[model samples]
Target: MKLPASGEGDVSPAVHHLVKGSAGGVTALFAHATGFHGRVWEPTARRLPGIDGHALDLRGHGDTVMPEGYDYPWAAFGDDILAAVDGLGRSGAGTGSGPVVGIGHSCGGAALVLAEAARPGTFAGLWLFEPAAFPPPAPGEVQHNPLVEPTKRRRPAFPDRSEALRNYTSKSPMDAFDPEVLAAYVEHGFTDEGDHVRLKCRPLDESQVYVSSLVANVYDAMAEVRCPVLLVQGAETPSGRFGKLTSQFPDARLEAHPDLSHFGPLTHPERIAASIRVWLEGLGTRI
Candidate 1:
């Protein structure tokens, strides 16, 4: 099947994506986690059979461009996913036998849950991979971590596009990816500035994004999701935190992989795809 162009323009100053799959069955819309672009799902998308797929670059990440001083909030991200879903429906991709599936990784998973909760039964099912749902740091317990909070609060300015790409690839957990994969990420993760290039995500903005996750609550929203939920977690991941609440969903099921890390989708896409295929088939949803 022809793979449709996956990136598009959004009205909210954010980047949108819609990857078409040739499966001619149910359509799946996937969102990537923080620090990664939507294309990370490409490997898994290629592995699923009989289904068309769509992946979006959430605001402030990947190809999505955000306005200056924009601190991405959890609610806005949720709205953006909904917009992507509506865009697909309008594009005539919503037709087929099965319900539309919303697949999300890390914080993207939380956004999906919130979107579904905002509108009950909006998706046929949900496939989430270790959504990063940490409890809010107690009143004064929040500490400073440079990894999560870079020294320069604003988006970094590199000497050139190549330098920007180097900075991104050097710091990414996805450095282990093939050269081509790494290139694809760098291509979407940076932008040219005059004669130089810089990361599109500002340091302070990203820090705010992380903190937003800590305080956001999707439990009530999860309860509202009427669709079946398939949670694929890294077994090595300790229990508690968000992992402990996996069982709360009405029809939720969990699958833990012993060797994968938080970045399983990038590190082990094939396995993630295989597991998703099995789960999708078991759901008996059309295409």
Candidate 2:
């Protein structure tokens, strides 16, 4: 589906997203990590029955179009979530008369925090996986994103999905992804050209996203988030960075997966879905 641009920044006029399951009971809005499209959540969405899952392709990722000279500010991504939520409400996908639950990972998780802070009561609850929201750097301290330089060197085109899959499978991080999940990533994360397939998220754009993460600190704003939050992280992810997150929120806890990594959602959808189901059920939600 297409939605109007968030209008929070110099963004394109349209936003693209994907929806699953029409048997609405509780609507689950999902936001993906940077460089990933919304459809990558399909594996987990299908695991939980009776959920109206709406996965948004954050600006510059997936099929969402972007305007020239537009810098990807993290706040604009939050507004994109707002736009999608409004669009869903208009379409009756989220007309339950209350805030919906949010499921997000990495950059997506931070964006959810930004949204809830920008507008209180925007979400009833949030299940975040290693959200990039960090405390503001101390005086004279400098924060840098190590992924930016590597992301700039990412290949932007491939001969086809097969080639892309092969290339990623042979690499580090991506090689850890679940086979099915990685397949979806390759299938929907690229667009076909006359002779080759190009990544929907250009290398330069994705690199900029990494650069923006360091400066978009939402730790203080999290105090305004009255909703319950569950922050999940793999044992491998340094607890030093994610542990303090629980203390920033009014009602929040941390969950660890010793067997999973930061990309646990993509590496083991079933496990992540089970955890989400248990948390949602504990909140008194049906199914």
Candidate 3:
């Protein structure tokens, strides 16, 4: 689906998304991490029954069309999430009829926080994994994000999807991902060209996203979110300061997995799905 930047009363380039599952049940809106697309949630969505899932591609990622000369801003990512939820309501997908849950990872998790803060009551609850919701750097402080250069150095092309899959399965971070999730990433995260397939999210664009994260104040907006939140992170690989973040939210809990990593959602979909199910059950929401 294509939607406006801020959903309603706002206009900007179209945002692309994929929706599935039957309506009249819980509605789930999924936002992906930087350099990853919406379809990466397919594995987790499959485990979730009776949920209307809407997975969105943020600007400059996946199939979302990025306007020329517009560098990615973290705030705009929040707008894109709002637009995706609004699109669901317009499509009669039961956005209001049932609970709306925001499931996000890494930067996607930060976007969800920004969205709910920007528009209170947009999400009934939020399930985030290692959300990159860092406090903004001090004024005039030199910001140094360690991930920027590595992101800029990412390989953007492969001889074929098979080669891409092989390389990722053998590589460091992606090698830790679930096979099915990695398959979905290999299939939907790239576009076919004459002789090769190129990653839809350019290395430079992804690097810009990291650079923008340095200035993002998503942590400050945490207090604006009034809904219950479940923050999940790998004990072995905590991304941000969860203790401080939990204190900022009105009602929130943090869970750490000893064996999981920052990519826990992708690396262990079943475990993540079980956690989501248990949390929803605790909230008295039907599966």
Candidate scoring better on lDDT of 1 and 2? 2
| Residue lDDT tens for model 2, 118-207 | 898788799999888887788998889999999989999999999999999999899999998999999999999989999999988999
What is the Cα-based TM-score of model 2? 0.92
How does each model score on TM-score? 0.82, 0.92, 0.90
Worst 10 residues of 3 by lDDT: 8-17
Which pairs of residues collide in model 2?
Answer: none
Clashing pairs in 3: none
Query: lDDT tens digits, residues 61-102, model 3?
Result: 888856545577788888888887877677665445777889
Provide the lowest-lDDT 10-residue window in model 2. Answer: 10-19
Global fold similarity of model 3 (TM-score): 0.90
lDDT tens digits, residue span 1-287, model 1: 11222222343323333445554467888888876667767767877866787777777876666777766668677877787777666556554555788888987898898888888778888999887555446688874444455534544677866665566567656565645456666676677778777676666667777766655777566777878888888755453544555666777878878677777777777788898888888887532
- Residue 123 CA displacement from its true place in model 3, Å: 0.6
- Cand. 1 Cα-lDDT: 0.70
Off by over 4 Å in 2: 9-24, 95-99, 236-239, 285-287
lDDT of each: 0.70, 0.82, 0.82
Q: List the residue pairs that clash in candidate 1.
A: 15-64, 23-50, 23-51, 25-287, 26-287
Candidate 1: where are CA atoms >4 Å away? Answer: 1-19, 22-24, 93-97, 135-147, 151-172, 178-180, 285-287
